[model samples]
Target: MNDETIPQITDSHCHLDFPDFEGKLPDFVARAAEAGVTRMVTICTKLRNEPNVRAIAEAHAPIFYAAGTHPMSVAEEPMVTVDQLVALSAHPKFVGIGETGLDYHYTSDSAQVQKQSLRRHIEAAQRTGLPLIIHARAADDDMARILAEEHRNVPYACVMHCFSSSADLARAALDLDFYLSMSGIAAFPKSQELRDIFAAAPVERILVETDAPYLAPPPHRGKRNEPAFTAHTARVGADLFGLDYVDFAAQTQQNFDRLFAKAAQYKAAA
Candidate 1:
């Protein structure tokens, strides 16, 4: 299909600054546009890499960014402060607070520090009025508890980026009016369980992503991923939701604009 016929969508999460896309962002962005992925949020997983990630966003009009010390890196990197994250939000293209949350899959040993960092990012989200981008793994209990607990203290928006978690965790996030981002992982053949979880969610709360440099969905599975492949994952979401591709795409666009209001405003003003 041509661009006008292809359903336009946003890759609500990705990592354009990773070495996989080094010196090749323009081509990737072009390919994404061709695939009808009109916008992308490139995530910064470490505080030190914020400048590089920010530069990627600054260099590409279709890109925006979010930064935080990822749970896996919490022990190795200095802990992030709410003030530092709030300050970064000053940039027009800095759109979200984190790719933060608990990840017991590999870094379970640093649970305490990860929790501390997650809370700080949550506070930053609270302070900046930006959605907190979360990366939850095998730590559903703690992740849900902390997020719900903190939301009670002061409400903040969030999206469970690249979400492939338990139905319980999904419900917890949805209960707090948060979003669940569907990545290429949900398009995997064996991801029926994950798809079922998403199928049970409110369509208004669903978003889509590529999580580029990883989880490239079928046809490109086991290969390096990119924003262009977001369409593959989104097709899966459309099927799961029993909606036509265009309708699902439009739903996600509305969901994205609602959660990432800054990026939506930027596009409107442009």
Candidate 2:
């Protein structure tokens, strides 16, 4: 599609500070803008990295950020607290609370620690009224149970970031008004099972992401993924939904706006 017809896109999730693009970030950012990505959310996976993440967001009018620790590292030194997360998120540019949740794919030995950390992150999300960015892999049942258990006391919006779990889990999140974000993995040929879930999800609940410096879609598969590559995932989603690229892009942008309501501030300026 031409620049005029390419719908303005928002990468609801990405790590702009990831080492892959550190020295060449400006060029990548320029290319992403040229590719029609109007806004992006730079996710912070560690409280210590929140400053760098926030700085990136602060430096770019179109970039927003989140504050929370990755579940895999929760048991490590310098654990994050609800107060710290709340404080870090006070910045006008900070709009969400995570990159949090269980990741059994990497370390299944500490399931309890992961669960506890996820609870803390969820609590922070509730305390701050910001959406949670969940990263669940190979632990859908446990993630669902924990989310359901905490839903009563710490109700808050959520996005199953980089969703690669079962359709049942997606249904549970949607039933709770949580959004589901699709990353480049959704565009992989081996991910047809995942695409089936996306195909069945409500368009209003679907958001697009690149999860950059990681999960680059086909053709770009082996290279670093970036916000500019989000368009491909959007294209794949649009194709699965039987809609044209423009319409699909518009729908995902709308989904991003509604899910991360604070994003509207950046969108308006864009």
Candidate 3:
């Protein structure tokens, strides 16, 4: 396919506000745009640094943001209340509600705290009418149950970001009209099951992400990840679906727009 045909993607999750990329984010974002990454959602891991996350989004027209504490980081600082999340998310640059959910992978003792935090974030999502960017690790059952119960009455937009869970969880999320975004982990040799899940996922519900400065896909695994490197994830997804890189990129880009609905408006006004 020609350069014009290759989709201009959105890095659905990244951390431009992280300390490691502070002074160097401009160049990193620029390089990503040059490589056809037209938009990115800089995820927030802490509620206190929301200003910093918003600053990055404000600096770049193609960048958007999500506001909420990560499950792992929620124990750190000023606890984010549902009201606070709703108010903070009123900013135009703020497009979604979370990197929030259950993660028992590392700290199993904090399950209750994470669950409460997840509920607060879900309430914030319901109040704000915004999409949610969820992070689920070893707590797939809890994740699915919360989503199912919470969504039954008040259906809200949500994406299971950086998914590395069971097929049952994947189907449950999709059944909730929640989008499933794949991260660089899908590119690993040990992740064939993940690739199969990606292939079986409805195209409209599929999105591609980097979860950058974290999961850097093959050839760059264990190194610092960035938005530009998300192309490797796109390549991995394309290879899974038996499509060319550009085609798969286009498909996932469309899914990203639909999942993060405000992104379309952001792009339109740009």
CA RMSD of all predictions: 0.7, 1.5, 1.5
lDDT of each: 0.94, 0.86, 0.86
Pairs of colliding residues, candidate 2: none
Compute the lDDT of residue 171 as modeled in candidate 2: 94
Each prediction's TM-score versus the true structure: 0.99, 0.95, 0.95
Error of 3 at 62 (Å): 1.5
Candidate 2 structure quality by residue, lDDT tens digits, 46-137:
78887788889887778898878788887784766778888877788888988888888888887887887788788888887788899998
**On residues 1-270, what C-alpha lDDT tens digit does candidate 3 reach at each position?**
445654688899998887779799879988887778878999888888888889889988888999888888866756779998989877887889988998898867788888888888999899888898899999988989999999986889899998889999999999988898889999988999988988898877878889988989988999999998888888888888888887888888878777676778767876
Deviation (Å) of 78 in candidate 2: 2.2
Ranking by TM-score: 1, 2, 3
Across 122-196, the per-residue lDDT of candidate 1 in tens digits comes to 999999999999999999999999999999999999999999999999999999999999998899989999999
Instruction: Give the C-alpha miss distance for residue 10 in model 2, angstroms.
Output: 0.8
Question: What's the candidate order when arranged by decreasing lDDT?
Answer: 1, 2, 3
Task: List candidate 1 stretches off by more than 4 Å.
Answer: none
On lDDT, the candidate that comes out on top is 1
